[model samples]
Target: MIAIPVETDNGTPMSTKLFGNAKFFALVEPKSKDYTIIPNEGCGNGIQTANYLLEQGASSALYGFLGDGPFHVMVRGGMNVYWLGKETMPLDQAIDTALSETLVHVTTENASLYLDPGTAAGACECGCSHD
Candidate 1:
């Protein structure tokens, strides 16, 4: 299954929020176009979302942004994550784009390019609570 982090409860549109900051996740089956939106347990905790997605049985993800913490956690857990670069598209198009493999596959070596420093490693400049 593919996990797409979304902001709306309906899960129709994708979120610009960093992966772990999304309010909900749309778990979809690319082939059947079936999806379910579930509350994100990790919420604003960047690193925790990695395991959360895994527990949800997400094998891959397509997100607008990611942080180094979750990047490493997801990668090490054997999940493939793609960077959808500035594309705040709807869930359907996002899934299509991912299926087309048009987005860049993120890796530790180049994670910084797509990683949101503010949210990376649970580092928040806004003095927010993550715990």
Candidate 2:
């Protein structure tokens, strides 16, 4: 499995179409310390972002957190959430945190709104809150 770590300020994944400030670190197995960087768009639509990653060959995503809406977006795009986060950390460390920490369960009727990993409070900025 290939591991892709994207450092998002709001923890909101962005569409692959636009170019922005988020940091994307991708790791392919069997090669130690061989993570590659992909340019990111700050924010756009959550589902688009997941689809972009899927097209890039990622089967799963490790993120800080996701609300009901964006979570479903990822799922529909064929990506699974491995972990959650409160803020952006080092790509490698964030991956470790997700692997070591417990994650919250998110669900929604609308697939687009279900997997919204924007933030705890669904805010892209600092004041976001969640379970």
Candidate 3:
């Protein structure tokens, strides 16, 4: 399953809140269009969220913006990561687009090219704060 962090279970457009702050994660079965929303127990920590998704059977994740910590954790855990197109893409449309394989495939080497440590003021980038 591919996990897409979202604002809610009924969210149309996926969440743009960045990986660590998403309120929920929708685990979608790409071909079946079947999905389930799970509340993010790790809403303030990117690494925790990434690990949580992995434990929930998500082999991949579609994300717009994320921090280095989560990006590393996701890829290190053997999960495929894709850069989500359009921050406002609808949940259903995103699922379809993901299967097409057009989205930029993210890997450890290219993670810095697309990710930020954090965008908040005074945010730490060393991944030392565990964000």
TM-score to native of every candidate shown: 0.83, 0.53, 0.86
**Tens-digit lDDT track for model 2 on 22-116?**
35535433235344556433234444455566667765565544444444555666655554434555555544544554544333344333333
Alpha-carbon RMSD of each model = 4.1, 8.1, 2.6
lDDT of 1 by residue, 3-93 (tens): 8888787625665556878888889888887889889898877677778999999999877766566777788889998887665778778
The global C-alpha lDDT for each of the candidates, from Candidate 1 onward, is 0.76, 0.45, 0.78
Ranking by TM-score: 3, 1, 2
How far in Å is the alpha carbon of 81 misplaced in model 1?
0.8
Local distance difference test, candidate 2: 0.45
After superposition, candidate 2 runs with Cα above 4 Å error:
1-33, 98-131
Better of 1 and 3 by lDDT: 3
Q: Answer with 1 or 2, whichever has the higher lDDT.
A: 1
Q: How many residue pairs clash in each candidate?
A: 0, 23, 0
